[model samples]
Target: MLKVQEIRELIKLIDQSSIDEFTYESDGTTVSMKKSNTAPQVVREAVINTPVQTTDTKLVKPEPVIEARKEVDMEKENQKTEQENTSISSYDHEIVSPMVGTFYSSPTPESDPFVSIGSNVQKDTIVCIVEAMKLFNEIEAEVSGEIVEILVDNGELVEYGQPLFRVKTK
Candidate 1:
């Protein structure tokens, strides 16, 4: 469980820092924070090339200086995201365990496993359970995919970022 004061301090840092994202891991807990982007003021300018007429003739030309402004393309960003998703599905992707703990196949003993090979899953689906410091933490899927393989057995010790399962992204 997170202490109230610690949580409050985290919120204060978020309010103070210019960073839009932060991630921290300690004592079997992982916390990720993100903030949205703000629009920037755009300025544009022009450029002119000056040529020397002759070596003997010194000519003074007023050149038009244009400031170049970068435009953000939404379509390109979307296409990149689509390409990333396509690549992720081409091979089995690792479902990383977030903490060091005793991994459980189910929330409790004598229950059917939370997931198995070839299980289809959404982002929020609980793939396994990890017990740390007597606290049960549900390990969730970050990607929507089908389980391709199980890397760890039930009751196995799992380290952070260890491959708990290999998934085939949809």
Candidate 2:
């Protein structure tokens, strides 16, 4: 029988390597592991063939332990995302990029930015420009508010629907 520490080490080695399957049997104990192609995780099975005086025997599987750990990790990640979202006040609105492009704070490098943090704006006010396929598209504030935060920097690549700025709605 392999100790808990040995089994953990073997799992780490198998996860880091290209091996798809592995099996080990000794002293009536057998451990088998197979990697899932679709997901980067391993499926493991353990069987102990201990000789007992009773005729009844059953195979025990330890896969549930691994699955429970995965569930816990997912829950932690969800909590983290929730915390980030809650950091912004409910009265705040986010200005998002309409298309994939390079974000520009100003029309030209030498010109002043259209909007900045603490700057008040109206719904139709042009806050910035997003250049996609060589076409410069002026982005509006969308909501009347004071700029609370600028999420993206000048000349940075912005994705469609990605938040570019946070505004405190008036």
Candidate 3:
């Protein structure tokens, strides 16, 4: 069995190296680690030999041995499909502004915006401000959910089909 430090070292090694597979075996114990950038990406895996308990020692414990980490060729196709699905779904479901303008994350020059990352909002909640022809337009949320990610920066100029906020489904 490898020590915790050795395992951590192995992880660092794997990260630094471009090689995908590594296996080490000694005596009756066999351990293996692998990395592959295959479709649906199976990135890393580490295996360790389990140790039996002894009455004389309580210092070391065995780690959960990783068996295998390999990319499934079949899932590669599914990954592309999923990407397409997400793109289409995201396109069909966005909070479009009624007019073109400079987008703002806050309600006023000094006031903080109505929403931020991980903020829970309703369908009609105002999320941002759009200044069109010197008029501030409150852009409301069309979907009710938690803000997953912010796509736009503060005081960014927004155009049609430009995403400003990404929301997680309720």
In the order shown, the candidates' Cα RMSDs to the true structure are 19.4, 16.0, 13.7
Q: Considering every candidate listed, which one attains the maximal TM-score?
A: 2
lDDT per residue (tens digit) for residues 35-71 in model 1: 5453221222233346546677877564655343333
Superposed model 1: Cα runs more than 4 Å off: 1-90
Give one digit per residue, the lDDT tens place, for model 3 in 21-120: 7777665455566655543222233434566677887645666444443434546757988976775564324566677789888877799778987688
Worst 10-residue lDDT window for candidate 2 reads: 63-72
Residue pairs with clashing backbones, model 3: none
RMSD of 2: 16.0
TM-score of each: 0.47, 0.52, 0.45
**Each candidate structure's count of clashing pairs:** 3, 0, 0
lDDT of 2 by residue, 1-170 (tens): 57767877777787679998888867645567667644333334443344334345554443322221121243576798896787576437899999999999999999999999899999999999999999999999999989988889999999999999988999
Off by over 4 Å in 3: 1-93
Compute the lDDT of residue 24 as modeled in candidate 3. 70
Clashing pairs in 2: none
